[model samples]
Target: MRPAAAGTTRLLCLAGVVTAVGLLPWLSGRNPALTVLRARSAEQEPTREALDAVRRDLGLGAGPLHLLGDWAGGLLRGDLGTSWVSHTEVGPSVAAGLQVSLGLMGAALAVALLPAAALVAPVLVRGRGSAGAGAAMLAAVPEFLLATVALLVCGVWLGWLPTSGWQGPEHLVLPAVALGVPAGGLLGRLVADALPAVLDERWVELWRGAGVSRARVAWAALRRVVPPLVPQFGMAAVGLTGGAVAVETVFAVPGIGRTALGAAKSQDLPLLQGSVLALLLLGLVAGVAAAFTRRALLGPALRDASLTLPTARPVRTHPAIPLTLFTLLAVTIGWGLLRDPYAVHTTARLAAPSWAHPLGTDGLGRDVLARLGHGAASTVGTATAVCLLSLLVALALGFLPGVAAGAADIANALPPVIVGILVAAAAGPGTGGAALAVALISWPPLAAHAAALVQEVRSSGFLTAQRALGAPRSWILTRHVLPSVAAPVARHALLRLPGIALALASLGFLGLGAQPPAPEWGLLLDESRAYVERAPWAALAPAVALALLAGLAVSGAAYAQGRAAYDQGRRTVASAVRKEAPVGI
Candidate 1:
């Protein structure tokens, strides 16, 4: 197919996907307002009939398609419907959330992009791999985990910030960092990867050879690179929306995420659908704008249909750094396990060391150490499992065109928190609830990554050359595509882990993670809050462990990234020398 035709097709497909996603809440037998009404009705019988009457009054009896069309028409006319859950106009509720979400996202984008730019500067100027790796490590740790730790240190220990709620400027700091740190890390990697390619372009080299200053070359390259990066930035925005949901819920912030969560639990379909649709529109607009911008900036070159850029070289292995970092993290986690951070030692308490009372006694005469140890294990185990499972589902679904299309629409349309709320309400708040929530929320990004990876691999010259050389399709996929795609996929997967962990932990912290007598980290933190005046360490220790684990994970990933950047630098230098040597000879 012609490149222009192919591009047009892709765009149309994406648009369709976005539309479908926007409509998913209604299609899935869950209306934001309806869900809430159902739950509310369980407590009071008249409420259900009244809600049903309200639904009818709102023209819901005319079928969903008609209702959806009316809703869309209303939206186009600047009317967002009424919020059944809040008894406010949907427009105002969404507007309020938008203000907070946008503000937070804007701050986060600045925080994320500035550091990323700084990291990229070194790569562009001198091609230092270490800087690249450091950025990657930063990206790998989840935002929630990092924020949780930051909150503890700043809010609890130092009393510098509020632990929860968005009252003022102080409320923004922790959430912004939670959103920005990983984003910055990811952006840095993108800049590091793209800048070199931009520099290698014939026009760039020609400009450089014409005695252009390094600064001018860098500026010119950035101009070209930045347009293509709009899509990524949009993706980051979407991710922030997802993270914001959990963050808002954890801190009891009055934002879209929390509202959506509340609506979902109450089965309020209207509010849920409206919020989701707004988010979808936001994503779609951003994505389409980016695509158009790229085409406009690149002009007819994108239509040439024959020109292709060079592929990045294989990432060099840095076994030592990752291994060492992993070992240190393991040790710390083990120490947290053994230290009995949750155990309470009392002189006059009935302390006994049995299978049940592993850590002896506590202030209330409870087995402190055993609870801590078990809880830590369960918390970590559940988080790890959810991350892996969610990623796997995403990967599989991402590979299927239909599934990808559905996921793209759903993800773009609904905020992660809304989805989490719906899933959690249906499943009930527990380990299963958290897992379901994570899976639903995490799958969208994972699928998006998988689709992009497949597309990139399919377009590579290596695959084309293999086909020309009569290689079997399966062989080409296995030998060429998989290896080329694995490293980036691994990086993305690792980067996603912390976010998943944080989401689960947040649920636990919110009194929804696990049942009583279970040693869940979030639950522990919640329990410790009661004793904050008497024994602050009980709360402080678990929070610290959560943060340390997340930070170490991020650091390890960054180390690997640094090594990858270093390898890329070596290849670029070698390539440049080889190209120059022939001219010299």
Candidate 2:
């Protein structure tokens, strides 16, 4: 954990990313010269002389290793090379996109603090803090879904702001709010959940007893509550920009996320690499900032106090929420399945909803309801498979630590969109590619959680006693270690399913997954974009379904977490009673 070692690790990771980006042309199993030639002049013949000329022009004649070295060297010299598609300097475009993205993210961060502040305001005024259920629910909604709804409600319905394009201040409002609201809700929920525990601490009691002002105590509590959340905030930073892929695409904001997606689609390696590098750096900088902020907030005294920062408990919600969501989704799917999704009536394209077509028809006149039902299996089912695979990978890597931890730390900085781009380059775009991309980035959170829990469990007195009694590592792990870790980690993974689905949807939206006529939610949204103004119903069905699915995941996870806690509490009480009971009794 020394500063020097950290710096070296970061440098190596940067080099690795650059190298990988450089080799993407080779990894993709496609002719780079032909791709570049097609991008430059699609009508040209693919002759040996022309291919050789293109290869020479791109410096690919020197081999991949040299190209990688050239890329690394250029990066070191503050050069981003030139785009094959546009034949322009990639640096300027990357910089412009990054500037816009940074500005958007900054505004979004400010907006995020609003809800966090709102959550804390009551605690400052009153004595206790409540983790608002609304905040938790809001946090569960995906950025793309939120962006779609914001566009529908604010732009299309209310006509308060422009729906798309990055023209002026007006365009920023919807995207910022779309990105910020969920983030704010998450931040507020984390702070609020941790606040009660911090306020109940002995130090807070002593401070209040000493006649400290309520404002000062609340401020202190906030400080204590937030340091532990630096990691979450760091991830949130990544989410704001990385999640911006869909948001940017939706709003037509020329941010780095959109740039990356476009570059991937066009096979513009230079542009794609530059955009990905920018995003990767953003994540790294956010992590550094989080660490620095955590230290600054703690100061020397508190940093040395060995304080165990309060962990936020999951938000408890009424069981009815999940039940209602599940029922609604089930009914919708069941009703849709009875209809044919692929039946195209050219005359009825973009038609309004009728008894025959409950959710209306898409641009191809394909039944929206049927597509929704059919798409569920492709989107949700794929997400479930990805989540399960991620869980298994997390378990394997988490307990192993060492190299796994180091690799996770590096990969944690990678956005799912960036991973999708790389995966698509290597394995072509499809549902499988999107699933693989999501699975690649999804395991880090679970792995980190499991790793931390494993470390804690391994060091416990009970584990020590079991070890002293000659218990095998496998036996101990299965009997004690896994039992303690599995439930919490599984619950964590469950809460993340919606995000996984969203990522897949984002990929599909970017044309990196589930091609035409697929009926995948993201792809459906993409297809509906052109005729959305004429018939908004084409877009509404999939957007609403995605949002509803997110809500279901959140509420379901909350219900399960609450039930587990209740069961644990009951067992604890029963154990205590048994311990205190008389021998005869």
Candidate 3:
């Protein structure tokens, strides 16, 4: 874990990720030439001669290894090759998309930071308890829903801002806010959770007693709290890019995410690969920036010592708020399930809410309420399966941290939506494919948690004593290590359930998940999009449900996190008390 080794590992991981994308054409279960031909000329007949010509032109029959080598070689020469569909060079297209994405991401980061900064002083002065609920509420709202609502209100109803396109700064406002607010909520929560621990450090009291200003003390504490969160911030940036698929599609912003989605849909491997590389490089840049920021914040101590920087720990928080939200969600789902989701009423299409159709009707006259209820099983059920499967995989990989951990490290950086694109290309789009795509990348966080906890448990004094007593390693591992790691990691996985659902929904919205006639939340939103401006309720029902679910999950997780932190605090205080106590006593 030296900095150099870590950096080297990351570079290798990035290479692995890019290499995987290069293999998409081979893995896609389709003929590259035919697929490209169809993408390029849908009206043309797929004769033998035309297929052979495409194969020769694209060197499709050369085998994957040779193709990959050529692509890599061209990459080194600053060539991104040509798009199969557009027949244009991929470089300029990717560059144009990247420019838009980078600007959007930068604006999002600023939006995230400003609100998070505003909360730090309040967290230092007040306790961390109240902030967690609010932060969870804010963070739980998905970008797609936010974009939809923003478009409806700002663009359609009020005409306050341009909703679609990358025309001007004015066009950026809605998308930026949609992407930024959730991130801000997360960042704010982390600072809030970490600040109380910093405030308890002896230096805070010393600084205050020395007549230091409150603002200065808060600033110092914030600086300490933030460095540990650099990784999370970097992940947030990656998440923003992943989320842009839906957000960009909703607003018609021509970002890399949108381009990648289009390429995936058309089976345009070269363009898809190039777009993914751009995103991967953006993630790399974010990581580098974070490392530099951390180094700057920690200064000499960061280099001089092997500091085990404190990360934000889960603490015990009040469960009432989350429990209430969960209840409301359950009730909504139950009510919707009682109605029939598929009963089409031509005259009632886009109808407003009424006694008969409680949540109103969609463009097809399907009951909005019923769709939400039925879609719950599809969306939430898949998400639950994904979470459980992911936890199992994480436990397995987490316990074996050699090559597996390194692979997990690589997989961690691949965005869920990008993974969805790859999965859709290989397996073809469906609910199963979407779940598989999400599960593919969801395990890394839990695995890392388990791996670190395993290391910590194995090194504990009690474990050392057990070893000296001639206990078998297997016995110790099963009795001590497994239990210790499993519970906390399971809780961590539960906390991530909502996020898994959101990822699945994003995929569905992009046509990579559930198809039409399925009441999946993402599909419902997708189905409602055409009429969203006219019949906002069609979209709002599912959007509202998703928001509620996110709020419940985040709030519940925050409570568990807060509770853990509280326990840790108590333990620290007791440890200190024991050290100061008289030996005889």
Number of the top TM-score candidate = 2
Q: List the RMSD of every prediction in angstroms.
A: 7.1, 2.8, 3.3
lDDT for each residue of candidate 3 in 38-106, tens digit (9 for 90 to 100)? 877889999999999997887777788987888889999999999887799999999999999889877
User: Model 3 Cα RMSD, Å?
Assistant: 3.3
* TM-score versus the correct structure, for each prediction: 0.68, 0.92, 0.90
Question: What is the lDDT for 141 in model 3?
Answer: 80
Candidate 2, 525-565: lDDT as tens digits: 88888887788998999888887887887788778877878
lDDT ranking of the models: 2, 3, 1
Candidate 1 residues lying further than 4 Å off, grouped into runs, are 1-86, 155-178, 196-206, 249-253, 265-269, 299-321, 324-376, 379-418, 440-503, 506-518, 522-542, 548-585
Q: For model 3, which pairs clash?
A: 314-561, 314-565, 315-561, 315-562, 315-563, 315-564, 315-565, 316-562, 316-563, 316-564
Which lDDT value does model 3 have at 268? 85
Weakest 10 consecutive residues, lDDT, candidate 2? Answer: 1-10
- Select the stronger candidate by lDDT from 1 and 2: 2
lDDT of 3: 0.82
Error of 3 at 533 (Å): 2.0
